[model samples]
Target: MRMHTRIVPLAMTTALLAGGTAAMATGAAGAAEPKGDVTAQSCYGSARNYTGTPGGPGRNAHWPATGTYAYATRNCTDINLKVNYTRDVRVCFKNTGQCNGWKKAKKGVWKVAASNVRDGAGFYIQFKGANRSTGKIAY
Candidate 1:
């Protein structure tokens, strides 16, 4: 009888943990869709912005510059995984001619995608941009 009491609670706890894991998995699986294409937002307010003037290829005082910024589109549409952007930003830039083929033509500009997770609502990313000739993310 004593064994039965111990087993009952153990079984219950195991069941709960299992259920929680399943719930999380379900959430992650839900966001596995193609997600179409990831996009980067133009420079704007905040220190990350670099659309004002042009800077040479070498690093600058600004944190994130504009140019051929490359990053993977990351979406945390799942319930289990928390957005791990604190370390490194991961995302595929939603390429647009608006930046004028900084990616397709390989203008030589390099940009890193911010790990900012999208709420699956109105999410936008910001990457590097260049003057097309210099291949630097000065703007």
Candidate 2:
């Protein structure tokens, strides 16, 4: 399978690498809404939301509904993941086993700026504890 990659801005990259929550502040304003096949896991109060184009199957209970989660303008650029939960949630940017770039969100809506997200690589969000959601960019 062919992988797609992109380039992002410097400021965004710097902020993400610094482990800052600046990306999260952006929220969903002017951001593209998630669209496509959305599958919800039966946990943490099952919910409904939009799904993007690139991702895996939608049955993994440990992960969020798998599908195209977000879109970016360029390589290493920024993709936003909007989290709407009622409590603090942990979001892992890439499924790298470890939540290395994971960010925490309080009760409310949050737009997580996933900076430096490369192509061939997708985005995944684990809400609550076991509800892991997945998405990717295929174009």
Return the top candidate by lDDT.
2
lDDT of each: 0.33, 0.39
Residue range 1-139, candidate 2, lDDT tens digits: 1222233455567768666455554554426443432211111122235332222355223233454343323433334444444322233545464443445544344344344556545455444443433333111
The RMSD of every model to the true structure, in order and in angstroms, is: 15.0, 22.6
Question: For residue 67, what is the lDDT in candidate 2?
Answer: 45
Clash counts per candidate, in order, are 20, 21
Q: For model 1, how does the per-residue alpha-carbon lDDT over 1-139 read when each residue is reduced to its tens digit? A: 9999999999999999999999989988987644543332222111122232233575221122444442322322211111112211123333443311212223233343332433432222222342212222211
- Please identify model 1 stretches exceeding 4 Å from their true place: 31-139
Q: Give the 10-residue window scoring lowest on summed lDDT in candidate 2.
A: 37-46
**Which prediction has the highest TM-score against the true structure?**
2
